[model samples]
Target: MTVKLTNIRIITCHGEEVIEKGEVLFNEKGILDVGQRVNTDEHEIQEIDGSGLTVLPGLIDSHVHLGMDSSPDPFANMKNEGPEDIAFKAVQQGYRFLQSGITSVRNLGTRYNVDISYRNAVSVGTVVGPRVFAAGSPIVMTGGHGHVMAIEADGCDEVRKAARSQIKAGADLLKVMATGGVLTEGNDPGATQFSEEELRCICQEANKASKTTAAHTIGTDGIKNAIRAGVTTIEHAYLLDEEAVELMLKKGTFLVPTLLAPRLILDKPGAVPEYMIDKVRKIIADHKISFQLAHQAGVPIAAGTDAGTPFNTPGLLSDELALMVEYGMTNHEAIYSATLGAAKAIQKETEIGSIENGKAADLIVVSGNPLENIRCLDSLVYVFSKGAIVHHAPVNKQEKQEQIV
Candidate 1:
């Protein structure tokens, strides 16, 4: 069905511009037109009067683990569930994200290749969810961080083979555990897990197949090594220093600063293992400072909540954006980081990042202007995914009549 949304404020992230009192025309295929006035007859198309609403491109999350439940101790919770149960939960999480206005996401790591399966299911109409860019499994060193859910490869040759294996499994991108992590027991978040040579090999293999590489880098040295190895994006650079920030700017590498992950871990103390809590306490202050440094230095920062990590639920991108604003970014910059910035991180900029003609109609309508109050994103009125009204808020008869002109 063709739909025309008129008299609304548009946060078209094509540039630093907003179209006030404009109309957007779209159908099942894609966006047909968007400007001050749509060039089509209003009689045949369904018209919606959005007088007090603001429309913007749907939010994108660049880092997530869909297969894991977002409990306080997801690792312990995973042991009780079987593979089928985990897969079912993953699907439910995807829908929850969509309902919360996230139109696209990148699953950086998951067990049993469930992320890839979920992405395929969505493509074939077997399920309805956000656009998923899946990484089948991360490549990690033996006994490295996330080795249980990842493919353990020690040497450079093994890393190359591991990269190819993920590609064979229909991975949209390749992720490498370049440094230790907080979740894994006895792992040092400040220590490097993968050497420069192994990381370079993975990057080379991914480059051959035209796939992007994301590095789970936290330590300063590991972050620099990933940058030098030509990784596309770095995740969770919690200990970024001046040199690391400079290297990122020089390499034009994007940073998926999943700020919500560590904060949540700290907030829900005693909910997780003591090791996890200690690790977060040690790095929480530095993490915020690193993010501020990256933002002020103009490093490309994408908003990702690291959903499925402890209390970091699937629908917290708004909170993540609000945190970014609290750190150093303006409201518009925070929104851009979640939209166009995230699309660029996953190499999907041409399709679903912004509200433009011929792009996918993945958009959300909120009650107030997000640019004025970023928290308004939490109040979504409608969600249009690929030109379909996937979610619509309930309203009274009189309110509905006034909205659906």
Candidate 2:
């Protein structure tokens, strides 16, 4: 199938310029051309009129959990469900994300290696979903944060073996619980869960398997340890200090702030426990300073909402972009973080990040300019993934009546 999109405003994220009247051409394999104009034989192509729409590369979410339920105690809920149930929920979430204009997502953690199976299903056209890069069951310490659904191991040797096991199970990436978390009861969010030696062992094992590592770190000490050990990305650096920020910049570590998690737990009081709410509030207050410091120090940042959490849905990733703007990023910068910056973190820069020639035709068209009002992303007119239209809003009744008359 060949598609010709013309007369649209395009933001390529290739440079600092926006093309007001641009054209894009795509075939069954990938994008063929993207520029100001390209002549095509009308008889052999399907034309899509984009007279007053803005087109952008499909957004990518770097941090997400597909198997999570919509309850506050999702971990407990997962424990009761079987692998088949989990797979069904994961496919549903994946389609929801696609409808929201997100063409790809990284699954940070899952139980029974369900993400790998689901990824294969999508690749073979048996399922309708986004491109998935999954991390099979995360590595955690016994009784540590995320232990409910993670593979719990202690000591350097045990951690290394666990990492190898995950790799053998077809994990695209390795996830380690480097620090405590808020959602799990009896775990202090300010404590480090893994020693430096253990972290280094996990990283080394993952490296041997030719896979990247993402550390779930929040405290300052844990953040420093993960950065020094050469992990690829840091998730939720809530208590980041000046030294940690500097080390991150020096080591060229990318940060996935997951700004929505803190805000969701704080702003919506009833979604979480009272004790959890207080902790989240305190963390949010402290996060403002560290987040601003990271921004001022030139640390690389990516937009990840940690979706599937309570009050954080898959289709609401645009809220993360708004939070970035509130934290001193321009609208274009926020959008770029969600697109090109995220692709860079996942090591997929050449494939699906931007509206460039010879790339996958994963794109979204909106009725208004998101560059001016970022909220316009919510009103998607059409969504195309891999040269196929996945979502299209129906024309209104008034317009249909006028056309009939």
Candidate 3:
């Protein structure tokens, strides 16, 4: 059905320009146009009076784990969760994100290739959720970071096989653990897990299959090694030093900073793993600082929340943009990171990032101007996914009359 959203303010991330009295014209296929006073027949069109709302390209989360649920005590859940249980929970989480206005996401890890299956389900209309690009499983050394969730493979040959397994399982990209993680049993978050040669081999294998790689690295050395090995994106460079920052700038690698991950684990008033608490305390300060270094050096910073991790809510990726603004980015820059910058990170820039006429009409309407206040994203008034009005916030009694013109 054709629809026209009129009398709204549009923040087009194409160049961070704002259009007054903007109209978004769309149909089942995609967006038809976005501009001021778009000429359309009012009689047949479903006209939405968005006089008090602001429109933006639906937010994109470049890094998230859908299979895990992000309650306060996620350690127990991840430790004992079964595949069927995780799958069921993921279905709920995916829709929750959609209702919360996240239109696209990248799942970096999951148990039993569930992420790939979820993505496929969304594609085939068996399930309804946002677009998902998944890494079926991550590659980790035996007894290293995320050993439980990842495929354990050591050495060059084993690493290559691991990469192939994720690709074979239908991963859009390959995720490799370049360093040990804090939450894993008997692992040090500050130590490197994979050798440079093994990391390079995995990248080579992924490249041969025409897939990109995301490195889960926390230590400075591990971040450097992953950059030298030519990984496509670096996740959680919490301890990035000046040298590591220099390498990222040199390689032109984008950093997917899930800043909310550690903060959530550290601040939650519940029983977290002792190791996790300690790790967050030790690294939280530097984690905040690393984003500054990358932002200052002009390294592309994309908005991602390690959702499904301990206390990192799935639909709360918008909150990360607020944090990004607080940390150093302007409101427009923060919004751009989650929209266009994230699109570029996933190599979908030509398709889903901007408000182009031919692009998919995955967009959201907030209660206020997000370009003025980033937190406005948390108050999404409407969510239009692929030209369908999937969600609309409840209107107050006083505001109901506004819907009738």
Candidate 4:
């Protein structure tokens, strides 16, 4: 199917200039052309009138867990649920994300490869959802954070073997638990879980398999170790010290702060554990400072909400953008973090990050200008993924009449 979206304002991160009145042409396979205007009447394409809307590349969420729920004991819930049940829930989450104008998502962790199965299903047209880069299961040390749902391995040799196993299982990326987490009980959030040598070995194995590694590190030491070991992205560097931040900037590592994950806990105190609530309350106070430091130090920051965590919804990633703006990021920078920066973090920049001529036809049309008010992202009227419209907000009859007249 061919589609022509005309009379739209296009925002591309490649240049400072914006196309005030532009058109995008796409077929079923991918985007065919994008310019200020294109000859479309001869092509027998379905023309979509975009009179007053702004069109941008589809949003990407760099960190997500597709098959997990935010229960009081999320790991215990995962253990009890069968794979079939998990797969169904994952598909549901994927669809929800698509509806919210997110064309692609990187699943940071999942139970038993359920996210991988869901990704395959979406690729094969068996399901209707956003594009997914799945990490089958995160590698963690024995009794470490996320160990309940992760593959537990000890030492460098075991870590290397475990990482290779994930690659063989069709993981797009390898996730490693490099430090203790807030959600997991009986673990210190400030402690490191994987040794520096073990992290290096895991990265080496992942590189051999041509897979990227994302380290889930929160504490200062773990953050430094993950950066030194060459992990592509740091999931949550909540307790990053000056040394760690400097190393990250020097190494050009991408940081997906996942600010919403901790902020959610603080905002809705009743949703998470009391201990986590208190921990997050303290962390939230300092998170903005850390983010500002990372920004000032030239560290690449991407927006990731850590969706599927307690109080974090799949379709509401715009909240993360709002938080980014709160942390000294301009509206345009925050939007770019969710789009281009996120794609770069996940290594999918060539395919779906921008509204380019040869990229996938993954775009969103919002009713208002997002540049003026970032929250206008929530006013999505149309969303397209791979040239397919997955979500279309119904236009009010009165508004339709006004447009017609």
Against the true structure, what is every candidate's RMSD? 2.5, 3.1, 2.6, 2.3
Taking all chains together, each candidate's TM-score versus the true structure is: 0.96, 0.95, 0.95, 0.95
How many clashing residue pairs are found in candidate 1?
0
Residue-by-residue lDDT tens digits, candidate 3, 49-148: 8877788999999898887877755545666887888789879989988999999999998888899999999989898999998998788888878766
Q: List ranges where model 4 is wrong by over 4 Å.
A: 40-42, 396-405
- Per-residue lDDT tens digits of candidate 1, residues 152-239? 9989888988999999999989999989999888999989989998899999999999999999988999999999999999999999
| Candidate 1, pairs of clashing residues | none
lDDT of 2 by residue, 1-405 (tens): 799989989999887768888899987688888889977675678887776678899999989888887566677788887889889999999999999999999889887889889999999999999999999789999998888679999999899889989988899999999999888887888899988888999999988887889999988899898999889899988989989989988988888888887787777777677767766866787776777788889888877888867667777779888888888888898899888888888889899788888999999888767788788787787889898999998545464333323
For lDDT, candidate 2 versus 4, the one ahead is 2
Clashing pairs in 3: none
Best by TM-score: 1
Model 2 root mean square deviation, Cα atoms: 3.1
Query: lDDT of each structure?
Result: 0.89, 0.85, 0.85, 0.84
- Residue-pair clashes per candidate, as listed? 0, 0, 0, 0
| Native-referenced Cα lDDT, model 4 | 0.84
